[model samples]
Target: MLEVYIDGATLGENGKSAASFVAKNKQVCLEGYTFIGEKTNHEAEFHALYFALVTLKHDYSDEILSIRSDSKIVVDTIEKAYTKNPAFLSYYNKIAELITHFPHVFIKWISDKDNKRADTLARTGLQTESTVIQSCS
Candidate 1:
């Protein structure tokens, strides 16, 4: 099983958003953050998961994936099969699509204390001057 933890941080003063993720027990895995330009905190949360999923799908297509996120909004929305905000529909749909590629995918909400690594990576991503245009894995 592939275990992934994801998080997103937004610099409210500059309107910059960044996302990060960590894959546990993978020798060569995508575990970093990238500047995603301007986005709301909610959007960034979705982006974090989206980027991680895209990075893992091609290589771990048949593997069981367990994704954890600190954002309750993202986790609840995905798990409940509904979104209250129309602005997030595209992101929501994209996540749903990517989930289909995995033989088994489980998304769960975790406490911030448990997601420290990803949270730190996300904050560090906001401090970087450059944006990553491609997958770093």
Candidate 2:
């Protein structure tokens, strides 16, 4: 069983956007970042999920996964409690596509405070063009 925590950050005016992931036992991180040129916070959030899932797919072939994030919309959409907005359906669908590969997938929501490491990493990724990625490979 593996647990993952992820988060994304988007600054003002294509300033910076990043996705950061932390796996169980505080072992390494899987992180990514890009200059959005111009995008919204919501888009960054989706990017976070996208990159996180992709990382999981490449890193773990046949393992059940549990993903945690601080994004309520992401959690709710995955849980089917809230309807996916038409504007975001495409991105959501993309996310859903990758999720199908997992034997079991769980998305959980936690407070921002509890997710500080991932959040900070996301912000750091955005600030630095280096695109920091740490993971126990």
Candidate 3:
């Protein structure tokens, strides 16, 4: 089974956000982070989940997935497998599609304190974006 940790963060007045995910097994660890331009905290969280699943799909599709997130909104909605909000539903739909690739998937909500690595990666992404923007000015 692969354990995945995902997190998202937003920075600046424009809400430039970033998504980060880490997938690791006993012998390997992979990390991914991307600045996803402007987005709400919720949107960024979904994007993090998306990227995490995509990462696992590429190399661990057949393995059991133990996904973890600090966002209650993301974890709860995914557990229910439904959402009424249009924006959230959009992500939910995409996530539903992604789940088809994994034979076994389990998601659990965790505290922010427990998800430090992913959280830091997400903030790093935002900081990197800010650096680029600042350098351009």
Task: Pick the TM-score winner.
Answer: 3
Flag regions of model 1 displaced more than 4 Å: 26-29, 129-137
lDDT of 2 by residue, 90-128 (tens): 778888888887888888999999988778777777777
lDDT of 3 by residue, 22-126 (tens): 888886688878889999999999999997887678777888889999999999999999888898898999898998999988999999999998898889888
- Please report how far candidate 3 places residue 13 from its true position, in Å: 7.8
Compare candidates 1 and 2 on lDDT and give the better one: 1
Better of 2 and 3 by TM-score: 3
| Regions more than 4 Å wrong, model 3 | 12-14, 130-137
43 Cα displacement, candidate 3 (Å): 0.8
lDDT of 1: 0.84
Provide the lowest-lDDT 10-residue window in model 1: 128-137
Please give, for residues 1-137, the per-residue lDDT of candidate 1 as tens digits. Answer: 88899998997844899988887655545576888999999888999999888878888788888999999999899899799798788999999999999988889999999999889888888999344423335
lDDT of each: 0.84, 0.71, 0.85
Better of 1 and 2 by TM-score: 1
Clashing pairs in 2: 29-134, 29-135
Candidate order by decreasing lDDT: 3, 1, 2
